[model samples]
Target: MNPEKALVWFRRDLRDHDHAALSAALSNAGQVYCAFVFDTDILDALPSRQDRRVHFIRESLAELDTALRARGGGLIVRLGRAGEVIPGLARELGVASVYANRDYEPAAKTRDIAVAESLRAQGIAFHTRKDQAIFDGDEVLTQAGKPFSVFTPYKNAWLKRLTATDTAEWQCQGAFAPGPAEGIPPLEQIGFMPTDLDTIGIQPGMSGARALWDAFRAGRLARYAALRDYPAIKGVSYLSVHLRFGTISIRELARAALADESHAWLNELIWRDFYFMILDHFPRVVGHAFKPEYDAIRWAERPDWLAAWQQGRTGYPLVDAAMRQLNYSGWMHNRLRMVVASFLTKDLGLDWRLGERYFADQLNDFDLSANNGGWQWASSSGCDAQPYFRIFNPITQSEKFDPDGKFIRRYVPELAAVPNKYIHAPWLMGRLEQEAIGVVIGRDYPGPIVDHTQAREETLARYAVVKKTG
Candidate 1:
């Protein structure tokens, strides 16, 4: 039975192709109208008006509108509260139903509920489908019928449960049902300004996602396992921003990886699902420790140290370099993310929330679940987290991952002229050596904020409240 009209609402799932809600709406309705909400409920909460994610979404939506126009429909974009706007749009279009992809964030869930209720009040049907993750929430659970807190068992079960149906593309066949030709507003119209996203080497929209995937597939996929750890090399796919924004579908990415011999990249995608599941099942982890006891461990209140870390002024080379990269570009190497996260939580003895908040503001690909999961993992306060005793040594990490200090040099140019031996710890250079290199430890670059050895011992004692053993 085909509905006379339907409205397909675009949220995080921005792309036109392989879109579950769009396909469902187009197939079931005689006329399907598409819409996207800028959602002031979300935008007003953002700390900055020059947010890169905002710019990225704007660019992606422009392309999406173009794509939808080719199918005899156009994207209806509005800047307002989604709860109010979605139902209003449905009423305006006189649609029988509203179709959308599911969002799992706590606030998003609440917003969706409100929207659903509003639509119901108007006697309109509202439908949502899983498009972001291959298996979200409890789809992959343990033998005991519980959500797996640990990743390995979850991954194993996830693989076993996978069938062709799970990865099959929701092909949007047939012409899109025609609707009003509303277009996206400019960034300035939405109270957002242009950012340095392009200058920092990021491309927004589905075409950009495809371009990055194609490049990654051409050569880097074969060496991803080996090179991904080294920040000096282009080992990682750089598709994370696209994934977060849903410019590309998860099914397409997973299916592409399945065709290849390597499964390392696929594991990363599974981690994304795992984090999402964790967030859905354990929403308390958003503000509290996942493991209750970890909360007992007191975090240091060092505003000065926090400032240094945020500004990339920390004395440790690798930590500073990673933080600098994040400050300069809206992204950082994944390996450096772990290193800096550990350094912030352990070495600095500061609250992980501080670093998490900073990353939330800085990362181009920030997702609340993934960001929270990563910070908790580094702090040993999350499920399947690093052991309380397993603090990362920033110096060793720098030497191992960036042997020639190329990554550090690129971000921390003050240490560019320092010798390879002293690059990771420029303070170790002798007075004569410093003079020879024309780089003074305290003058050219600030010294380490805190001694690593002393900080390590202090951190061990501090974390002993949670666990005695490293």
Candidate 2:
């Protein structure tokens, strides 16, 4: 029995085609209305008025609304807390059911529960379907019927359990009810302002995702595994923001990875699912360490060092370059993310939470599970994480990844005059060499804040508490 009227509440999944919840609504309901909420609960909490993510979402919603209009429907946008807005909208629409894609974050889950309870009280059903991940929760557990804590075996199991149907599109059909004449609100209306998204070379919406995917598949996918590590190369797909907002489909991405046998890219996607699973099973990792013993390790309190690192004045070229890129563009290369995380947690001896929180604020593609997982992995306090003693050497990392200093020069322009040999460690240059380059260590560029050798030793001793606690 299909509901006479149903409303599809758009959340992260913003696209029209191949949407699970949208398809479910169209399939099960006689008449379907589409809606998106500005979600003041989230928008109000943003630290910045000029957030790139907010701009991205705003633009994406415009495209989504247009797409829905073409399909004889339009997006009914509202501005309020989603828990109240969704139920109230359902009541106003006189709908029997409301559909949405499931969100895995703890806060989202809580909000969904409240919305469901409210909807239930109004004699309206709230339904959520999985659209974010190809496999979610217990879908691909171990033979023991328990979620796997480690990644490698889980990847193997995930691959083994994969079938054609998993990546198949949830076809959206049936008529759509046209929304009100007024479309999505402006940035100012939502209490946000325009960001540098245009200048930073990011394109939003399904069109943007399609463009990036086409470019990656046409040129970079084959060489992705080989060239992805270098920050200077256009080797990896820049579809993370789309993935974060659900403008792109995970199933579509997985299908491409599987078809092309691009194991490297596929592995990265698997990591996303792995982190989501980790967050699902161990919500405690939100603030604490996944490996509980690691939480016993005391981190140093150095406000100066923390500020230096955040401001990209760390005196380490690669670390500074990475931070500068993030601060400037609101995006960081995947490899640089690891390098900077290691530098922050291992070299600077700051808490991983600080870096994680900073990333959560800065990244345009900030997904809670992945951001938290990466920080925990770098700090060696996560499941299947690297050993604590495996600290990244900033200079070596720079030399290996940005050998010609192209990436460094782009972000840290003061180092543009430094030669290749001394680029990775300008402070190591002779005074005469620095003079020849017309750059002084402390004047033009900051010198290294902490010695790598000393920091590494301190990190080892600091992590010894983990072993002691065990």
The best candidate in terms of TM-score: 2
Clash count list over all predictions: 1, 0
TM-score of 1: 0.98
- Distance (Å) between predicted and true CA of 57, model 1? 0.6
Q: Which stretches of candidate 2 lie over 4 Å from their true place?
A: 1-3
Query: Candidate 1's residue-wise lDDT over 142-261, tens digit each?
Result: 889998899999999999999989999998865566645557889999999999887988889999999999999898997899999999899999999999999999998888788885
lDDT, candidate 2, 439-460, per-residue tens: 8999999989999999999999
The estimated TM-scores of all candidates read: 0.98, 0.99
**Inter-residue clash pairs, candidate 2:** none
The Cα error of candidate 1 at residue 48, in Å, is 1.3
User: Each model's C-alpha lDDT?
Assistant: 0.90, 0.94
